[model samples]
Target: TEGLVMAKNSSAADQLELIALAVRGNVSLALAARAVRSAVEAGEYEAIARALADQAGRNDPLQPRDRALAATVAAELSRLGSKAAPLWQVAREAWELERSAWWLAYALFREAEALLSAAGKRDAARDVLVRARSIARLLEAAPLLAEIDALAGRGRVDLGSPSPQLLDPVPDRKLPISDREMEVLVLIAKGLTNKEIASELFISERTAAHHVGHIFDKLGVSNRVEAASVAHQAGVLVEDT
Candidate 1:
């Protein structure tokens, strides 16, 4: 889990650099996947989402290999046990932007599983899986279809026909805090001092203080406790289990 450790400590820009290097053949896809997995596990969710969105929004289309890699990263995020909603949102956005029906279906499938397993919304989850199954059929993706069948069999849930709106992308909402600021906020919530946050995030104490100041301003709070309160209320921080 060296990659995971590195990703937890590195800045978002450094993580993106690793991805770029992978794309340019300076690093292996395995390393790229590790970086992506690490980012997801480290809760650098917004950073990953924004990077994928930016790539998707580019006028120049992504190469097939890059698209596949992006899809892989999205899929990995979708499978996370916690924070699945945000991750699935990012994955859905990427697949929709790419117009990859199969990948979109897969993303839906994972979201449904997360809903069922993590959130305990069985009926809603089944509905989403139904949407995924329909898309898989339309694309003639036998593997995806088979996986859907397996999921249905295992869950013993009767899936209905797809709802027309089930696969539609949710509108993107902007967060008040930047990704770097969010990282600082999370560490602050953990009761880390500025020096500690700096060490954890691999930045200077002065830079960490600067980020803390920005976070306080953006959140309209004067201290770490108030900042954590605002972040929790805003749903920026995951609920404690």
Candidate 2:
């Protein structure tokens, strides 16, 4: 449906209204999924997360792609501290429903990401990344391959090679902060609060907080002072532009 496009620049209330209407009217599952995505992209977390979990968990049939997408979104929201659904259960269900599909690979990538972030789950994440890598190569999907490889490097997962050349992830960077995280780190070094960081970077405050959490984890710090000290020592704390 054209509802997603129409909701693109819409207010939060309008987007939520359209989604509620779609759900109540029994619109196409795919259309409702698109509406959910649009709302998520606009940073509507609480209501969107609740609605997504309800639809995805309902007994209705879901297409393979939509199933994986729902899982992916749920996992990301879970990472941001939403109480919608458990990440492991959601991710596993998405792949179990459609093994050996491109969408499964994407969901697995997200699963690996969520696992990698959790304590004591690096081994599981590595295993999931290996599976995702195999599918990416099978599909000859250069982009997905690159994404998985980069993630593997960051997570320090040594995905064993078939022919060795098939898994050429870039070497783990000495400093593992991503480009966007680098931007956030710089802002953090300047003592910006999460809301201030969001305003400066044009991202949702929730996303800004997520980035800060990742930054702290990657830098092995609990607070901004420690994070900034580590960055300065690592020479990643150049003057903020």
Candidate 3:
């Protein structure tokens, strides 16, 4: 009976409301999945790719290349599997992708590395590591590089050992404080009570106490004296030797 209803009552707005309800409830993800499959069947490659990538990010249903382009990619990946050698060119291609999108590179590297390592090809695995490190250097991503190094070595080598390549430059901070917060912290470092700090900053004593508490938290210290020492170390305050 409802199938005979006119298009006016079942407007786009009504369709949208139904979509919202389905999404809010996750009532039928299989139906949603079928919709995506239908879209892919309809030659909506761009939309399918975006949606597949999003699902990949969310760890949802794994992509089995339901689209032509993705199927070609899967075939290419299969052909490029580490059956022969390290293939530096392939490694470099993976590195370039890694530089552009770390997660994407991560996916490719994980697959390639698994194949190489499983075959007991340590040299090829090390080559993959070198390319990954090069990409990491380009991106200035220390933590990610460290993680890759750790996984590449498979605990055979200690990652914490200091090496020239591991040294990422530290950034300089001027006083390590914002001007507004520094104004209040300096008064505290001068041995002023909270009430006195309030009088100096023209704020309430309660507000002054709150600021001092925040200062302690930021400095990672429990008391005023340690906070002062941190401030001096941070160059927020100069102390004569």
Candidate 4:
């Protein structure tokens, strides 16, 4: 229940914690999946995508378990119409490099789902699944083969186009500030000192100062005053009425 609540809150960090708990036998896989789905729905797509990318980058050859998990998450994001193309590419490359047939088949199945659900490329999706089925058959992966068959049997159903709000363009003058760092910048704009900002954000003053330094570096500013000015000029800060 706590896991579900955390999922409902859409905190990517909390969802990742829930996943760790699942790996430790403290939570169910279903609950973890729900939490991840909720986080994606809540616009935590970049966090999840970044996490998957980090995981893919950690292992040189990409362990089978890691590859499977990354592929599964990428596929689920695709099903939810998230921009998971990069994640899919990472999984595909890892599998190809390792020559792991079973995981490759699994990744292919998910890649097909991404193609169909996210990109709306039906013919391409079918071709991907066809290749997955071939690999599954060759490796005697019965479960994967069954899944491919079921997907093929269902035919195409509209999953609805992605929402325009989800397609909002990144700012041309986007700084490298992280989401938390942006929050720090907002507080700075409000004229909050580092100690006050730390209190407001429930972090230590040292941490707040660290974020301020990062904000300065990312925004190409030297001090809080300059950072605040740049934030306002860049339309990154909202003014009070």
Which candidate has the highest TM-score of all?
A: 2
Worst 10 residues of 1 by lDDT: 162-171
Which of the two candidates, 3 or 4, achieves a greater lDDT against the reference?
A: 4
lDDT of 3 at 132: 60
Q: Clash number for model 1?
A: 0
Which sections of candidate 3 miss by over 4 Å?
Answer: 1-101, 155-241
Using lDDT as the measure, name the better of candidate 1 and candidate 2.
2
Model 2 agreement with the true structure over 58-140: per-residue lDDT tens digits: 66545554555666666666655544235545766766776747766776787787666565777888888898888888999
Would you list the clashing residue pairs of candidate 3? none
Best-first order by TM-score: 2, 1, 4, 3
Candidate 4 residue pairs in backbone clash: none
Give the lDDT ranking, best first.
Answer: 2, 4, 1, 3
For candidate 4, the TM-score is 0.40
Q: lDDT for each of the candidates? A: 0.64, 0.68, 0.50, 0.65
Candidate 4 residue lDDT tens string, 16-114: 776555454332334445656777778776665655556546543334555556655654554444665556767777788778888778877777766
lDDT of residue 151 for candidate 1: 65
In candidate 2, residue 132 scores what lDDT? Answer: 83
Question: Which lDDT tens digits does candidate 3 get at residues 132-183?
Answer: 6666667777877766664543313222343332211224645454554676
* Candidate 3 RMSD computed on C-alpha atoms after optimal superposition onto the true structure: 19.5
